[model samples]
Structures are given as structure tokens and as C-alpha cells.
Target: MKLQDILTPDCTICAVPAASKKRILEFLSSLAAEKLVNHDTFQLLESLVKRERMGSTGIGNGIAIPHGRLINATKPIAVLITTEQAINFDAIDHRPVDIFIALFVPEEECQNHLCTLQSIATIFRDKQFCKQVRQCKSNHELFQLIQQAS
Candidate 1:
């Protein structure tokens, strides 16, 4: 699956003002909920939190991909956010995170979920892509950057 297939401009945010990891997750959870058939933010948030308990999704270099699987989800949904300021995220590199691309996939789509994660992780690994994303000034700009990058 492609990142563009799952993520829409409507689900991206630039310069999001969040102070902590929980707040960031809550915000992304809200975005994910908007696309869910059940519209249950709490359930999605719980799944994300549970995943974090197992291990942080922060792969380093100022990025984090907090993700989870929802049993009732009909398909995958993704949200991208750039925080106004970096926040500690327990990243492997111990650096604060400013970029977050969160995902919620249907529980049954294991292969698709893995591929999507791999795609996102690969994209974020590009220093130039990460730099361009950080330079975005608005959600519209961020959305355009993602489209252009793809």
C-alpha cells in the first residue's frame, strides 16, 4: 500500500502545538477517529497506548510513527503532524521528536500494515524529506510537500 493511498491532506497538520507525547497521541487519535466507521477515539487511543507500552515507535532523527491496529477498522488511516516544538518521546537516539506520522490499520491487514509502516519509515529516513517537512509553515504546505515527495 502507498502512503498517499492512506493519508489525505485533511489528516495532516503543521506546527501543531503539543507539549507532551500523550497530548500528541490524543491529537493524532482524534484525526484517526474521523475516518473510522465506529468513530471511537478512546478505543484507538487505547490501542496506540498499548503499543507504546510494548516499545516506543520513535525510530530516531526527530521522528516518531505511533501506530496501532483496530479490530473494527475497515481500512487503514494515517495522520501526519509537525509539532510547534520538539518534545521528548523516548526515541532510541534520545532526541526530541517534532515529526509524527501516525497510523491505525485494520486488525486483519497484517501484511498491508507492515508494508505501510515500512514505506513511512523509509520516507522519514531521508534527511532531505525530513528537513523539507520541518520547513513547512502550514498544513497546506505540509500536505503539498508530502504529495510532491511521493
Candidate 2:
């Protein structure tokens, strides 16, 4: 699946005021829960935290893809956020992260999860694209830039 396919303007937020990694993940969980029916924000947060405990999703260069599986998810859902300030995310490169792309997929769709992660990684690998994402002034602008890139 494509980034544009899973990402919507409603799920794209810009200049968020999250001050820490945990707070950001909580914010993401709440946002994602609002979009998904019969989903609990705390449960979603647990899933993301569980994954984080295994390893940080931070891919460095101010980007982090925090993803998890949900038994109730019927399809993949993505949320994109940009913080006003970068926060420590325990990234492999030890750089603070500001851009976040959180994903939730059906627990059974392991292959789909990997493919989606690869697609997101490919898009974010472009330094110019990451720069454009960071420069976005509003949620609509950020969503538009991602759609245009995809």
C-alpha cells in the first residue's frame, strides 16, 4: 500500500506540542483511536509501547515510525505528526525525532506491515522530502506535500 493511501488529512497534524516521546505516543494513540471504531487509546498506546520496548522505531534524521498490530484492525491506518520541538526517541543514530508516522495494522497482516514500512522508509529516505515535511506550516500543507510526493 502507498503512504497516500493510508494517510489522510485528518490524521496528519503539524506543529504539535508534544514534549517527550511518551507524550507523543499518547497523542498518536488518541488520534488513531478517534479514527478507528471500537478501539481504545490505552490499548493502542500499549501496543506501541510494547514495540518500543523491543526496539525504538526511530529511523534517525528526525524521523520515527512507531507501528503496532491490532487484533481489531480491519486495515492499515497511519497518522503523521510533526512536533514543534524534537524529543529524544532512543533512535539508533541518537538524534532527536520530530517527524512521526505511526501505523496500525491487523495482527495477521505481517507481510503487509513489512511492505508498508518499506514504502514509508523509501519515501522518507529522500532528504529533500524530509526537509519539505519539516518545513510544512500547517496540517493541510503537510498532508498535501505527502500526497504530492506519493
Candidate 3:
């Protein structure tokens, strides 16, 4: 799915004030709930955190893509956050992640999930594009940036 389809204006946050992995996940989950995602935000956070335990989703360059699959979901959703301070993610590049793009996909949508991830990853690979997202300071601006990418 396109980032624009899943990323709502409310889902895009600028300057998350979290400093650790758990805090980051909690912050993101709260955004999902505030966005009216149809699930227990804390449970979703736990699943995503478990996934992270298996392996860090931090893709380097001050970015982290924490994601998970859920049985209750029928579609995918994205939550974007730019932290006020960088947090350690145990990334391959060994860098702190400041920009986070979390995804939640339905258990039945494996192929779609991979495609969505590929699309997000490609969009993120463009350092300039990622820089633009990082530069956004408001929810409206962040949604616009994501829309432009799609």
C-alpha cells in the first residue's frame, strides 16, 4: 500500500521526546491509538517490540522502521515520528535513530506487507527525500511530504 493511504495526518508526529526503545514503541503505539487504529495499542506495541527483539528494524541513517503483523488487522498502517533526540536502535550502522516509520500489517497480507515495506524502504533510501521528511516540523507538513512520496 502507498504511504499516503496508510499514513494519516494524525499518524505523523514531529519531535517525539522518547529516549529508549520501549519509550519509543509506547509513544508510537499511543499515536496509533490516537489515530483510531482498531486494536489494543499496547498489544500492538508488544508485538512490534517482540519483533524488534528478534532483530532491530533500525535501517541506519537516523531512521528506524519498527513493524509487525497482527491477526486482527485487515490492512496495513504506518506511523511516522521524528524524535527530538536520537535513540539507540542497535542498527547495523550503529547509529542512533531519530526518524521512525512503523508499520502494522494484517496476518493474511504477507505479499502486500513485503511490497509495502519495499516501497517504504525505497522511499527512505533517497537520503534527500528522507532529509525532507526529517525536516518537517508539523503534522500537516509531514502528511504532505508522505503524500508527495506516493
Candidate 4:
């Protein structure tokens, strides 16, 4: 499925002002509530955090793909954000992460999750695209950027 299919306007966060991993994760976790992902926002946050602890998903170039699977859902939802200030995320490249795309999918549809991750990686591989994303000044701009992408 395409990302725009699930990226509602409220799910987008542009110019986020968080400065640390905990804050970033917490900020992302809170999106679950905003988007009505599930009843217990805490549970979703804990699940995502647990997955993160298994290993850092930050691959470098100021990008990170944090994702989690839930047993209560049947579809995937995504939240993309451009932080106002870069934050160290223990990325493999040891650089600060400024672009974050966190995803949530049902546990029964694991392959779709992989495809979503692949699509995000493939699109972000273009340095110019990443540059444009980092340059976005507002959520409308960020949403437009994503809409322009595959």
C-alpha cells in the first residue's frame, strides 16, 4: 500500500522541537492518541519502545524508521516528522537524526510492514529528497513533500 493512503494530516508533525531519544519516542507515542490508533496509548508506546531497545533503527543520514506491530489492528498507520533540531539517536552512522518516520501495523500483516520499510528506505535513499524534507518549514510543506513522493 502507498504511504499517503495512511498518512492523515493530523498524523504529520513538522518542525518538532524535541531534543532527545526519549522525547522523540514519547512525542511519537503521543501521536497514537492523536490519531486514535488504540485505546491504550501507553501500551503502543511501550511496544514501540521495546522494539527500539532490541536495536537502533536509525540507519544514518539524519533519518530513522521506527516501527511496531499491534495485535489489535488490521491496518497500518504512519507518522512522519521533521524535527526542529537534530537529535542524537545512536544511529549506526553516529549522526543526529532529523527526519523520523515511525510506523505501526497489525501483527498479522508482517510482510506489508517490511514493504513499508523498504519503500521508506528507497525513497529516502535520494539525498536530494532528504534535503528537501529537512528544508520543509511547516506541516503543510511536509505533507506536500510526502504527497509528491512515491
* Candidate with maximal lDDT: 2
What lDDT does model 2 reach?
A: 0.94
Counting clashing residue pairs in each candidate, in order, gives: 0, 0, 0, 0
- Candidate lDDT scores, in order, read 0.91, 0.94, 0.85, 0.84
Per-prediction TM-score to the true structure, in the order listed: 0.97, 0.98, 0.93, 0.94
Worst 10 residues of 2 by lDDT: 34-43
Decoy 3 TM-score against native:
0.93
- Our tally of clashes for model 2 stands at 0
The better candidate by TM-score, 1 or 2, is 2
Predicted candidate 3, C-alpha RMSD: 1.4
User: Which of candidates 1 and 3 reaches a greater TM-score?
Assistant: 1
> lDDT tens digits, residues 37-108, model 2?
867899899989999999999998999999999996888899999999999999989999999999998899
Model 1 misplaced stretches (Cα beyond 4 Å): none
Off by over 4 Å in 4: none
Candidate 1 residue lDDT tens string, 1-150: 877788898899999998899999999998888878785889989989999999999899999999999887788999999999999999999999999999999899999999999999888889999999999998999988887765
Clash pairs detected, candidate 3: none
